[model samples]
Target: MNAEHGTPASAEPGTLRPGGRTARVRAAVLDAAGDALAEQGFAHLDLADVARRAEVGRTTVYRRWGTVTGLVADLLTDMAESSLPRSETGSLLGDLTANARLVQRTLADPRQGALFRAVIAAATCEPRTAEALHRFYDVRVREWAPCVRQAVDRGEAPAGTDAHEVIRAVSAPLYYRLLTTAEPLDPAAADRAAAATAAATRAGAYVRPSPAP
Candidate 1:
């Protein structure tokens, strides 16, 4: 898309504008970066190369992102913000199933899967990249934490279950499949994850709430 298409007009310094010409430019650059990272890997992700692919000037890319790590960090933040909110299905199994399905769907998508693989590979060699990846997971995990908490309130899971950890457990295997095995991230995988997580919660894997003291 052209810079004028979705670029934001008033982004703070060193950040992509929220919406307008700058936003469009940022999206294009991010798309180009995803392509380059997937095709060539992080070692080959040159700002100039991304600029050329995005049809933007080198100065604009540099002025906004400053460094490769910075760009990746911003991309992660944007993705987290843009991702769908957690589902409130009112049951531990249902919520976890929803969460698992979302994870499977995202990792199975062509562009998103490739983008994650690129970032994962980059993380192995760069501390900053690894940190950014962790931050991305943190955002996603936090987003779904309440579902676990709600399950506890409903007595579906033991009170005091660490909501964050429960949520993480649901996606851990899915990510493992994405990063390691060539197995398809199908609904079966999602069902397995949901089942495992629900079973664990029922078993009191989550901490129980403290009794009145």
Candidate 2:
């Protein structure tokens, strides 16, 4: 279920650019899809059910998305496009903390948290969903990776720091906390996560390894 992929393939149908009726239909469908995923999880996410909630025809939904996997993949794409842009605070710690707080807030939201958990649970069983999940993270990681580069340019981090790894580190603990324990996600936890990762990066712990001999 850990299948990997890049951008979703061009083979998917029902994809639409922004604006017009097509865009509106896509938006409505995805919103309903998210609602179903949050309420009943992936296993229960039927395309027909989604169409009914979206007030779209079953044939339209089927023709556009083709399958549940295709619909989910498009949903991930929409999510990436709609997500907030990365913060630029002119400091590594500040940027990292901002990213951490964003992640914490997302996990703390009831509907959003349930949607993510449902996707993750489904990804474990569906290879296509797993690939889509990986792509979603890739988009998110790329979105925030520049902060580490800016830190390197500003001499705030080591020259060879792995920017993506640093960013992931800042969020990993928060996600772990969310998934493992029943603890409430608070601002303090986000700050601690950012501080710990920033300290590690400063110490060269996240430097990319040299290629093996």
- Quick one: best TM-score, which candidate? 2
Looking at model 2, which ten-residue stretch has the lowest summed lDDT?
1-10
Clashes of each: 15, 0
* TM-scores for all predictions: 0.87, 0.92
Give the best candidate by lDDT. 2
Residue 63 displacement (Å), model 1: 1.3
Residue lDDT tens for model 1, 1-213: 325334344553224445667778889988788788778778778889989999999988877777888787777777777899999987999999999999999999988888888888989989988987898899999999998888888888876799988988999999999989998999999999999989998898767567899
The residue-by-residue lDDT of candidate 2 on 1-213, one tens digit each, is: 111112244545534554667678889999999999999999889999999999999987887788998899888878878999999999999999999999999889998888988988889999988988888889899999999999999988998899889988999998898889999999999999999999999899988888899
lDDT of 1: 0.84
> On a 0 to 100 scale, what is the lDDT of residue 211 in model 2?
86
